[model samples]
Target: MQENKNEKPFIPTLGITIGDMNGIGPEVIIKSVMNPKIFDLVNLVVYGHGKVLSHYKNLLGVDKFSFNQTNNAGQIRYNRLNVINCVEDIEVNPGEETKEAGALALAAIQKATEDLKEGKIDAIVTAPINKNNIQSDDFKFPGHTEYFTEAFGAHESLMFLCGERIRIGVATGHISIAQIKDRLNADVIRKKLELMLKSLKKDFNIGKPKIAVLGLNPHAGEDGLLGNEEIEIIQPVINEFKEKGELVFGPYPADGFFGNSSQSKFDGILAMYHDQGLIPFKTLAFEEGVNFTAGLSAVRTSPDHGTAYNIAGKGIANEQSMRSAIYMAKDVLLARRENTH
Candidate 1:
């Protein structure tokens, strides 16, 4: 956090919504922006309860953290971290569930989403929110993607788990295991793969990306002996993409794809289900991995981990994931602007 002598706002504002208050959201964020190098890349607005963030500033030794409220929505003053605080009647207890924390987190997200739609910010990168605490009957979304889809009324969006070594995009995310077979249609897979490739090219800046498709069963259905998902569901979709000259291959077994012997075959991977992609991804790259939502009008990324409530307010929490998320958002925004020009 740096002062501009007289102080002024920075461009390409990065809107960061604090996740669950009972977790490490504020802790990691405090540690992240304390470096001041962050101000050089993007001006960050910490969307959270002002008190919680103030507590964090003291804990992290950032004596200069300050926020000046603005009358105009776009008229944000960036001194260190601009906080649009939403006060709620919640106790910030570490490793506990409470409605106050939940409501606070939701308000920040909604505000940031509106700002993104209005073009006030170039992108939004979120920290993890507690599902059990925040989810209610009215809040029907399983995660941010569902909520964003419903917000934008978009027909489809893709969830891609990104890592330095590999990236995995799901054909369908957050659905039942049994429903996956029914959902694995050629049109759906083709659409997801298309978005994945486009993301690789435009966001990731890889011109000719190679993507490997993972199978839905053991031994890749063992040529239809163990299961037919490979033959009946996956292969047809993959073959169609290959015929169109995309560098797509597989219906390969998930086990062998991430194996030490076979991990180098592709630049990215298309997984059939949740655990099929996430297990290997987290195993290899959880510390620095990022989650990006594809097909959104604006860029939204997050650290691929949840708020560690048990470690909230502790100075020892890791900032690697949050740091990676910020860098990823900047990278994507720059690439998108370049491509558009």
Candidate 2:
């Protein structure tokens, strides 16, 4: 995507939250900021401990990596990586899940969120966090999407997995398979579809987008012999959109849809549940996918994968997804500006 030629050259300041240090968050973050090309697009600021970031810089042996360490975003400089020390100095453990690491992760997110609310930063790109350890009285939500929804004051949010080719959103997120049936309803499905449609038009620059919705059951309930979700609930919603002259179609069998490579036909897709969308998404774009939280008042995104504990600190974790997340945030910020103007 190109910037509007009539508009002034604008660069957004993006805040990066360093997830659990024991994970590959710091490793990928250090690698991403070290590249000089990134500075040409936007100013970078990391929300984490400067000491731990320095430790990882030395561990990775990247001599070119240097950051301006400060506590205030106003002091951030262009063409240099900036570090905001949100947590105190602590031990650097690469692979173990410690309470300290969890605390640090949450601290970075909280500080970044605060800054976003204050307009200290333009957008946020979060690293992977261990959901199990990050749980506390303050963060009782299941994952980032939920926490961000309440934090940013959005009535609803969609877990939209974005790739170069295909983008998929889920109606039900971070829930068990058994609960999928009970959690899904017309209201929830309609809200997710609304978010995806708006995001595609505003954030993706698609004037009119074609959307596909996946069925909850196999063979789309095999004509209601297997299950009635498609016949009873999902189809009614699809028909309602069709009546309004919207380009929405579906209740497609999830297995056959991807199996037949049908995802390429649409601009966006809506899945009934989490695994139904993520499994195929990760398989196709494991190293490049971005998990974007749509329908929020603020811009937020994250790497599609999690903290690879087995490969943590190995310096082998792929930074493509991290890099992609950063670029996506920049793209969305610019797109939003153009739309608002």
**Clashes per prediction?**
0, 0
lDDT of 2 by residue, 109-211 (tens): 9999999899999999999999989999889988999999999888999999999998999999999999998999999998898899999999999998899
Off by over 4 Å in 1: 1-11, 59-73, 88-90
- Candidate 1 residue pairs that clash: none
lDDT of each residue in 55-166, candidate 1, tens digit only: 7767667776566544234777654677777554446776677888888888878888888888877788888898777777656788987787777776788888887877
Task: Give the residue spans of candidate 2 off by over 4 A.
Answer: 1-7
Model 1 RMSD, rounded to 1 decimal: 4.5
Residue 181 miss distance in model 2 (angstroms): 0.9
lDDT for model 1, on a 0 to 1 scale? 0.80
What are the candidates' C-alpha RMSDs? 4.5, 1.9
| Cα lDDT, model 2, residue 121 | 95
Worst 10 residues of 2 by lDDT: 1-10
- List per-prediction Cα lDDT, in the order shown: 0.80, 0.92
Q: Pick the candidate with the highest lDDT.
A: 2
